[model samples]
Target: MGDVRVIEVKQSVFAENDRRADALRAELKAHGTFLLNLMSSPGSGKTTTLAATFKALRGRLNMAVMEADIDSDVDARAMDELGVRAIQLHTGGMCHLDADMTAQGLRGLEALATPDAPIDLAILENVGNLVCPAEFDTGASANAMILSVPEGDDKALKYPLMFEVCDVVLINKIDVLPYFDFNLERCRERILMRNPHAKIFPICAKTGEGIEPWADWLVASVRAWQA
Candidate 1:
């Protein structure tokens, strides 16, 4: 061949993104904001769990939500109807939000905060995908994932990285535990095998069966992060 060229920018790209993510995290901490990047598969009751958290902690803290998805503003609209400061990030076919994308989304959602309406906690409801989302850090102070009872107990074995990276895991839709084949013990054992320090909570988002403790822990963690 007369001329040949090869270029590899993957490492540089990721390094730059990681640098930006660190800066974003520092900026958020300076403003006393705790960003939580929540991930889960579609139909895992992430939105429902968020609603429960809101109800459980309303008027208790300054909170906002950023809903990320491939398309549709349905979740954002739902948050808005609740009178919560919310923004929607459309990934335009991207299955996950990387650090740079998260920074951009935060910029778009900036209008939600002001001196009179400051944000103490900003929840980034990440796109529905256990794979790509778990591979990227969105500069969140804490990360959480939802695993509904209907999703089966073998998820930890199939999606080890997701469970391993999260600080907390919420087992949603526990009201149907009797009907589903989900085994709490087996799931916990598998998750622990991957992430020994993972905090697991079994709850029903619709009825708020076990949401109080989760909400309480969230509030405390936000405070500690701010500190």
Candidate 2:
């Protein structure tokens, strides 16, 4: 042993993030706001699915949206066009949003909200990197991910963390399943291995085939969050 002292690092960098996430959750709950953090790979049909979801749930609840990306305000503008309050957050170059970033985004969204039009549900469309987004908690009341048929059934295996952390999983573009070699049963099995209780739904967002049930489940979830 030389004349030097050694220090041990016992806490993880994620520890602080997780702690802040818990606090954000409590704050959101106090306001009766249910924040849903949505994640997926690029081109997962999140926008189309979200559009259908808004159509189904509109006028049933007070809703808002926060679209996060490295650049561009396109999605936020699109959501605003749907008659819902929307905000776009630019990460500058970061790939994921930690609890603090999410809180800041929510604050911006809140400023646009009004007492006559309070938000009961807020959906945060996170940056489109399954791996990075899944590694951080955003204090959402629920977490969900969309997996398109083109992405293949193997995604659940390759991106286990995404499936593991999500409370809900939507298999979008089911109408195109016949054109692909995707195995629905196998994919379900793989996801169940990571999260046995995940509520999985198959939907054709463009065709509006499965939007009603999804919207119903989501509405129930938002109300339950308040309770």
Candidate 3:
């Protein structure tokens, strides 16, 4: 029998994406912009959490948001109303944004920036999906994901790669924790098991509770990244 050849298309694609992501990171460093990739499943209050975060860090940082979705401008409109430079990136049925897509979004945001308000922090609100987003490197300085209380505590176990890749995980909707039966401590434990270095924040985005620490961490991270 003749020898069979196998092509590792996925591996090659990931390698190329990783290289492009590294290049994008260097470019962002040169521009002094910190790109944060935020991921979560649908109904995780991702946009609400961003609104709270925007309110918290509004004056401290010149920020912009790129809301990525398969098809929707709602989040982009919501963010723009917050008085920040916000744009929507349509993924065109793609479940995740790759480095190239992220770079395009950044360019759109850069065009929206002004001399007085250059983007120091560019946030990529990735498509609302846990799996594909985690698998793709979107050239972000740091990766963050939100797991709302209603999503349950075992999400870390089910979506281990998502937890493992995230630099931070915001346990949003804490105000409803009482009704959801979600174990915060156990969730933290599971996340730590997946990623010991991840910073966990228990926050109620609706009520603005437990947001300060997360905001402070973000501010520190941006400042450090710029430095």
Candidate 4:
């Protein structure tokens, strides 16, 4: 007879992470907080957009931001100065934040939110890296990608999965469109082809151009999600 087989089960690579994400989602729903996972490459205006967006929506929404970076707290500091409850998550050299990291951030924000108003909005500015971050679920109500004109319009074709998974796409740095060869129509066409349900908004974060509509759509979206 063959020797008795022995099998040792091991920890799930995504066990704690998925659990935390589920809990975080439940907590946010209870607090009426809408979470948006903003993802993009470095210099894609993710931070700039958040700074401007939170500033615009503060009076109307109880907003907070969770900034994720590999090392620096600079983005978090900037968002804090804007009067939004902001916190920095250092991934300690990790390329991306899993559900576990976002759960901790949610707890911190929960502590700050008032019980009455609670946190109606939680913007999670994901790590600068695009590919890895896109792979992890951070317990956000929606996934958004900011693609700057400088990054070129062909991005959707190259990183198909990111565009495929995102619910919204922000075409940032549009004010500089005159300099770049980015064709807005082509970008929209390609991205929409990949994600038929995606809502695309073009805006220049520095000049605050086209922000109102974007923020409006965002607010309406969150409200609809609550409903």
- Which candidate number has the best TM-score? 2
Output the worst ten-in-a-row residue range by lDDT, candidate 3: 70-79
lDDT of 3: 0.91
Q: What is the C-alpha lDDT of each candidate?
A: 0.86, 0.89, 0.91, 0.84
lDDT of 3 at 35: 97
Worst 10 residues of 4 by lDDT: 70-79
- Arrange candidates, best TM-score first: 2, 3, 1, 4
Clashing pairs in 1: none
Q: Which residue pairs clash within candidate 2?
A: none
State how far residue 146 of model 4 sits from its true place (Å).
0.6
Per-residue lDDT of model 2, residues 110-185, tens digit only: 8999888878999999999989999999999999999999999989889989999999999999999999999999
- Tell me each candidate's RMSD, in Å, in order: 2.2, 2.1, 2.8, 2.9
Model 3 misplaced regions, further than 4 Å: 1-11, 70-78
lDDT of 3 at 129: 90
What clash count does candidate 3 reach? 0
**For model 4, what is the error of residue 160's alpha carbon versus the real structure, in angstroms, after optimal superposition?**
1.1
TM-score winner, 3 or 4: 3
> lDDT: which candidate is best?
3
Clash pairs (backbone) in predicted model 4? none
Q: Sort by lDDT, best first: what order? A: 3, 2, 1, 4
Candidate 3: give the clashing pairs.
Answer: none
